[model samples]
Target: MENIVLRRVIPSDNSCLFNAVGYVMEHDKQKASELRQVIAAAVASDLEKYSEAFLGKPNEEYCAWILDSEKWGGAIELSILADYYSREIGAYDIQTTRCDLYGQVTPMEGAPEEFDQTIFPVLQDRTIGTVIEGCALKLVEEAQRKRSYTDTANFTLRCGVCQTGLKGQKEAVEHARATGHVNFQEYS
Candidate 1:
């Protein structure tokens, strides 16, 4: 297996980031809309909080990751936990029809031709679930590090279907059910 490149997200990556999201949404409609709304709200409400928590933090500490293969495979956002990721969060969950109509189709519009240039690799290889696993691991690692007397990280993600502990966002969606664990559908 080749080495994977993981790093923090930047402000310049907005378009490409949405492209990746669009790519994932191709699988499901309702779920996709819910995720987009969640992420958009999080980004809009307190962007500075996300930037500091996900970008300013150290790798495997508090930041999210975009896993990319050295040769093929594009990047995916993982470990999307933030102070504002709540199920009761208020935001307009866009519909799939709106997403498609708005040109948020597969292969990611406004992305580069090359795999590296595109948001999530021009060529899709790994499943979205795999990307989620990487994200969960990163979150767990960060929570472990941030464990303090007053603050502690929580590993509360459960498989939406099986109810077992899910490794990533894709898995949670793929296995959409009452998986016992409370899942926060953010960033499809």
Candidate 2:
């Protein structure tokens, strides 16, 4: 089989999503700034399509916000990038094994062609892709058996902002809503 290997590492910064996507598509992390500019330009090119109601802010404001390197990106940014690249972008949640796909929708005429430049947890060329998949599943199963994943529903969390204790995800959200605190730490 062809040598399938894991993609390059992405820094776990606020701009990780941008960096990850750029690395997968272009094998470059410096593209984060350019990707942000791409998103801003996409929004600017279509104000009605990316309206205030659609984006939860004025187009100009949203464009400016996306250009800020400290800002975290979300669905709108992903969707714009997907359209710009004409490729289906998938974000996988490791703990949940959930994959969210962008650019899967049929595009209007004159849109760019669709292709896949993706990420993977590829095992080195020891055996095959199925073997790699099986290894991953086995690893996940072992982790589950060990209870290595955090139980967000029943775990103890502390609010980093106010030092308030929270019992679970619900409580954490409540604490954030009450005091505008967003950072939480999990502890036993």
Candidate 3:
């Protein structure tokens, strides 16, 4: 098997899914806000297609919620993004070593002629978690073959300044803010 290398995009806030999509597109997390706008517009334009069943709420309400920076992205948004971009999206659950494809169900009109793939991490909670493109699926497959795949959800965060450890990102971020400790590293 060819060596497959992947890059990780850490979430700085609740917009991690948007950030991951932006990262896959532009390799920059800052562009997530723009991606969010694009997604919201796309979702708004096709409310009938993206109904309450897919959104878990009325289309308009879901669009508004998605536009909120505090709101996180999920599978429905991933499907929309894949359609909007006209590319195949691979959502990988690191915990389960499972990958699902979005936007390849039906033929897309005016899609690029070349086959393109984008990979995004799906967190344990089923939320669109992180972005990892460029041979990410190959890397995952290789890890699975080697029995070395580890779930990031079980990783612990350690404060760089005080060596304080936390179980999750939420707690780690809170710890950093409360104690003004800016540096943290994840340990499994």
Candidate 4:
């Protein structure tokens, strides 16, 4: 298997990442060309707004990793919200990082150890399912530990085919539903 690079999202990566997402989403064979343009604009806008914070120490409590796929194959974003409040949803005073995005699934278990240490971060190759499970557990633990987080955490996991809902209480429930395991089950 070919090893892929995993690196922090950088300025130069803007178009590549956007296009890769477009490529993945394009399998639908719809108006992917136009969709790609929209994605590019959104990514560029994000870069303009957060590029400095991304590189600085404060870290914006947010970070995105790009799969080293020559272009950008997969990406994930994590964010730590400090003073988050939502009235319609009825939540407040939470310090939790949202698992913003989990890019196309990457099977990490069978990956060469050399690549693990050399190329990807622990989270880089995590399957969308794995990332969702891990994030859910972390969110549950964080809320329990703090107690001030008098609210709930909700998450969505986008596998290659389906989008599923996961809650703090239903960790295993979600995994069992991921019936099609491409990269993960084989390696395990």
Best by lDDT: 2
Which stretches of candidate 3 lie above 4 Å from their native place?
A: 1-3, 101-138, 141-188
Per-residue C-alpha lDDT of model 2 across residues 53-101, encoded as one tens digit per residue: 9999999999998998867787888888888887767654456644463
- Tens digits of per-residue lDDT, candidate 1, 144-171, equal 4554111112223544444466445455
Task: Order candidates by lDDT, high to low.
Answer: 2, 3, 4, 1
What's model 4's lDDT at 175?
A: 53
The backbone clash count of each candidate, in order, is 7, 0, 0, 1
lDDT of 3 by residue, 1-188 (tens): 12224435446576877777666655565766787788888888887887889778998898787888866677877887777777667666654557874211112333332322334445696533322333456566665776553334456889989999887767866887799886777686
TM-score of each: 0.18, 0.58, 0.54, 0.21
Question: Model 2 compared with the native: what TM-score?
Answer: 0.58
Candidates in order have lDDT scores of 0.32, 0.68, 0.64, 0.33
> Highest TM-score among the candidates is held by which one?
2
Worst 10 residues of 3 by lDDT: 102-111
Q: Which ranges in model 4 have alpha carbons more than 4 Å from their true place?
A: 1-11, 23-34, 38-97, 108-188
Error of 2 at 114 (Å): 23
* lDDT, model 4, position 82: 10
